[model samples]
Target chain A: MFDNPERTNLEQLGEFGLIDHITKAVELKEPSTVKGIGDDAAVLDFSGKKMLVSTDLLLEGIHFDLRYVPLKHLGYKAVQVNLSDIYAMNGIASQITFSIGLSSKFPLEAVEEIYAGALLACQKYGVDLVGGDTSASVQGLVISVTSIGHADGEAVVYRSGAQVGDLICVSGDLGGAYVGLQLLEREKRIFLENPNIQPDLEGKDYIVERQLKPEARKDVVELLARLGIKPTAMIDISDGLASEILHICRASGKGCKLYEDKIPIDPMTYETAREFGIDPTVCALNGGEDYELLFTIRQADYEQVKGQPDISVIGHVTDADGGYELISKSGNVHPITAQGWNAFTSR
Target chain B: MFDNPERTNLEQLGEFGLIDHITKAVELKEPSTVKGIGDDAAVLDFSGKKMLVSTDLLLEGIHFDLRYVPLKHLGYKAVQVNLSDIYAMNGIASQITFSIGLSSKFPLEAVEEIYAGALLACQKYGVDLVGGDTSASVQGLVISVTSIGHADGEAVVYRSGAQVGDLICVSGDLGGAYVGLQLLEREKRIFLENPNIQPDLEGKDYIVERQLKPEARKDVVELLARLGIKPTAMIDISDGLASEILHICRASGKGCKLYEDKIPIDPMTYETAREFGIDPTVCALNGGEDYELLFTIRQADYEQVKGQPDISVIGHVTDADGGYELISKSGNVHPITAQGWNAFTSR
Candidate 1:
């Protein structure tokens, strides 16, 4: 699958040689990282701060199609997915350990490209690339990332901390990533049918980038801190807005009222959903992988976040007895249910 | 392949259901665990101490074969392997994040058995299962474990700290895991040839368990601490003696003399290797996955650890120009070379 001009076989360098070649350029940027890469275990000091740990596993075929997903983008997204979890907890990620398993079909250059992308993300996020494991897989590529971060214990946001009357807010836009995936998948089928036809992905850059290069909402977290507002409950939108909102309500032992008209959707995403004969509202509610922040803020703090262009107030928290409900633009009220994709059955 | 009387398909529980079912029984025993599971990230308190992090990825066909490996043992061994890296650094592991991707072929009971084994290891090691990710793979099972630990700055060890006059010591015995694997492969071959034949594995419990359920050298680390001995350099013997010692030598810019006769091999391992027409010394030198500690201490501190039965002083460090050499039983000296299994090329 790799189309690189220089194709060095994996066996020629061996596992240790490949690790050295890939990580030789890695410079530890975090002061917390006492040791990185060379040792059996990386050493870090997060004294006086509570540490946050999260991991994500991405499998080829199940998570992404190699035909459309570039190796560099796959590696970058894998790290981003894990980092989003740390941000969701209002923590700043300081270090990450990336592990990968791939078959011999991957050449040395392909592996290098993946690490280059991972290192780029680490550099941009100001996190050190710590220790990791690399091995040969029997089939496709598998990536697992563990992100370590720290925050003051009192400042950490949790899904179970929402209170009644808290305003539900979301950052940036939603449904763009899911729309982007649909566009990519459609183009893949066309290319497979006729290799001569190039992918017609022009002018869809915003949505396509959403699918290929989603970034964690680090800026949103910083903005909230600058505004001196702490979210009562928070989660990253990975398994769609409906699923994530349900998680918050379940954990907090409360319910929420979501307004369909208030859900943020970019113009490009809305038009693309209509082109695919799908409801844009449905896409925003159930389409996942946006990496946007969904959180609850006390009513008194609404004035500070409402003035921010990127933050959209969508709903409000309610008592558990009220049940989760959605208010449509036409004033139709319906129970909000989770239609999140179950990886086990969806594949 | 599963012969269990009750089989619950993974799809029946879905991703969230499966995670809840598996982790409902997990009890957070560590005081450092501020929050375990059920959140965007696991919160931990490692105040005033340096945190040690390590990760390991295991693939089914490449790292193991289900035809011979039981699910519970596989789960147990995966955790042990990662924890061994922490012990190699003279750190006490306090938490682990386990991520698994398996195909639908596995039943819920099988997954439960695997988690049971992992939890059992956590209980025994005084570590907490803090966070993890679960997803469906397209093929066989995949597990990635990240272990986090802590140790005092002075007590922590690294492979690059060895000096010229330091003595080399190894805990427990070597080569039993490899010899046991050979026996298991033989039994499988015999069973494949005759479907009705019951293979003989009686009187081979020690070697067989070594292959299936190898334990990390936590006790050895404890013993050294109690005896007021700290190794200048330390590493876990996961990649055989020659390869690990070479790592120390290369990292420390030093060399070593290893005596073949001093290499400790269990009688069961030696007998089994002889039965297979393989040299026991060669097995001890190159057989991976022993999960024992190989370390170097100052020569002046030799009297304290010399009487310890489990610790074997096999050799001493030398200058970089001296090169790595092994002294044979007949007094012939030869350069020590690494024959550790290269996962990429070996298959």
Candidate 2:
């Protein structure tokens, strides 16, 4: 009964097009709303502190594979994924609402166990379980989480503040989650082919845990405040370091140089990559879902957090004319590509 | 690699158990958060105003049937449901975040059409479109919308605020959406058996629209403000009138009385119910997807809003001992039972 040409094929305009088109019509008239749409979380004024709101949805067979994934980790990961957005803005998550599409095959207790894991994460993260809806689904389960956080208005960070010569830092390790997925898929196929056989899962604990229960770098956000250091720009590393670097570069109108050797890859991840016959550096650069924090800090403020063992200065913001490049240990420089997690490829 | 207690039948807990179990381990320590999980929305202090965060998820084949429903109304209804929860709190909706999961079957055109409907609702409701995430799905479309609204600390209404002898008022007519659903289902069966048959939806325009494009009651909220009246208790009728009445009564620890003849049903809805051989009154009380506001006001303020055509004073809230009952035109008292919508019944 309704057909409007003004709004057409989303693919024709692409995902970014869909977002840009929808956002153009929005009018953020509220005086308290400092920022909307562009940041990791929508910023809201709440007395002395600011409120940050962010939402995300994960679907079965698309965002996850049930064959190699447990429901508990899925639930925990859903909350963490949403929380990462709030932390990206230097905000502390305070409340979360989880909306789930429940398939009929899932019984009451099974679903509760999933929520048990989610509520556990809420407790760990110090966010309240607010409000959500549970509806029947025809296929696998779908979970959507919205997290709201609080921050000092002046402390809120955006993705467009990287200046030339600023240092790019990443928290903890990278490429472990992607490598972990490969290991799980490999074992899953072997087990599926012969039900009687017990597959081996040794020496790959770190990578597997990274895939299963990856914690968003909330600690880094707190540590930054503790050390009295501020990031000029910040974004989480979910869509691989390569894509995230491009997001910062494009948004900041600056180029970047990532030192290959400086990228932190755990020993388990490197060893696992060798076993799988894949390059660890490429896996870290292109494989996604690390949940690490990729941010930029002023050169002068770097000294405050430089001694921290967990955070690593992997690269530096360069002039736009410099172009995005990665320098390897052997001194070869290659252009960094924005090949991250592509949901459309599976379809 | 994933297998456990979910293989067989497991249904020990009911809906209440599910909710309690889901919320068991959550902790809310934020000072700005006034209420969480137990109420309709997460209440927070937005400076002097009380802010609310509520979320809802709508799935294909469960909440809607894609066979007959258009993508535009589906998108519009998704946003409206979340806005309804905000309106339930007696607050002005400020912003919304939309998360969607689409299957490969849908071309990009369909996704854009859905957003067009979402953007249209945002424009009509004066709410800002903030942030959301989208992913791929294997089967059907799933949409989750989170809405944030704010009201003065003193003016925010909750379900527990109702008192004895208060007047129960409903904004706009009911039962049309329910009757419209029946018509759509009946036509879908016929169309499924033979695609050549056309849906006879010409004469049932109002009922069809009611089912297809339900609007949130921001107007009633505005009118109440203009008339200098605050509702003692409020809820949105997304799960039929009888179910909502039971909720209000349960929360307020009181009972209510309704005049059967006074219940508002559009003429077209009545005709459709008659055509479908269903009780029109029962449909008015139990039909859902109306997205109308249900509130109770003090008896003295009845004159304040009685002149408005859209605002219907259905009945009065009675004492705790009164029990929930309906007084028919024949002077017979009948106990009202809650027959809320349950999506568990697949057919």
DockQ of each candidate, alpha-carbon based: 0.86, 0.17
Residue-wise C-alpha lDDT for candidate 2, range A204-280, written one tens digit per residue: 78889899998988899999999988889888888889988887888799999999999999999998899889999
Which residues of candidate 2, in runs, are more than 4 Å off? Answer: A1-45, B1-47
| Residue B286 CA displacement from its true place in model 1, Å | 0.4
The TM-scores of all predictions, comma-separated, are 0.99, 0.87
lDDT of 1 by residue, A25-80 (tens): 78998989999999899999987799999999999989988899888988889889
User: Evaluated on chain B only, what is the TM-score of candidate 2?
Assistant: 0.86
Worst 10 contiguous positions by lDDT, candidate 1 chain B: B1-10
Q: RMSDs, each prediction?
A: 1.0, 12.7
With a 3 Å backbone cut-off (N, CA, C), the pairs that clash in candidate 2 are none
Taking the tens digit of each residue's C-alpha lDDT, what string does model 2 give over B1-347? 01333322112332223334434433444344443443112324466565677788888878888888888788888888888888887888877777677765565557666777887787788876665666667868888899888777677787878899899999999999999999999999999999999988888889999999989999988989999999998989987899888788888999999998988889988888998899898898888889899999999998888888998887888887999999987989999987776665454
Error of 1 at A69 (Å): 0.5
**Residue range B218-319, candidate 1, lDDT tens digits:** 999999999999999999999899999999999999999999999999999999999999999888889888999999999988999999999999999999
